[model samples]
Target: MKAIFFILFAVIAGITAMAITTEQTTIEPLLTEEITTETITEEPTTFETMPIVGDEYCTWGPSYWCHNKTTAAECDATTYCTNYVWSENTKGL
Candidate 1:
């Protein structure tokens, strides 16, 4: 019957169209570039001398003592540092 022939022709046309479209389509991975970062930092210094009077040393209160003024300054620059010098408490001579 003419209907059957028309159906068969339509099916073949649709198959051919699909095959052509699939061949024309491309699938490829995206291109990516790698990135890197580097940093240079200086090490902190330490002091070896004993504390002197009238000189301001770094301290966290009545306890911890920092090496020197510079070290105290660095500590104070941070979020967890307070610099102070304790006045010597002595009695008679």
Candidate 2:
């Protein structure tokens, strides 16, 4: 009776070990595929305008000006434009 019980226990343990090994192998392939897919799908970043420049002032073109005089000094330092005509209320030349 003891011999029979020992044989059954050994068989059950062998089967459980085999199942765990198979599951680990299957999951490893899935993880590798996910990492490859993520790397392939990544895209480079892009910008429509220059960074750190004010939106109200024209940073480009021949006729560039800073609309707000309060921040005109900062705008001129950043954009390099001398024309600071309009106040906060006024818009355009």
User: How do all models score by TM-score?
Assistant: 0.28, 0.34
RMSD of each: 23.4, 18.4
Candidate 2 lDDT over residue span 1-93, tens digit each: 999999999999999999999999989877776456777788978868766755456454324435344454544542333334443355332
Question: Number of the top candidate by TM-score?
Answer: 2
Lowest summed lDDT window (length 10), candidate 2 = 78-87
lDDT values for all models: 0.49, 0.60
lDDT of 1 at 20: 84
- Taking the tens digit of each residue's C-alpha lDDT, what string does model 1 give over 1-93? 999999999999999999888765632222233333432244558878987763653434423333344554455632222323422331110
Clashing pairs in 1: none
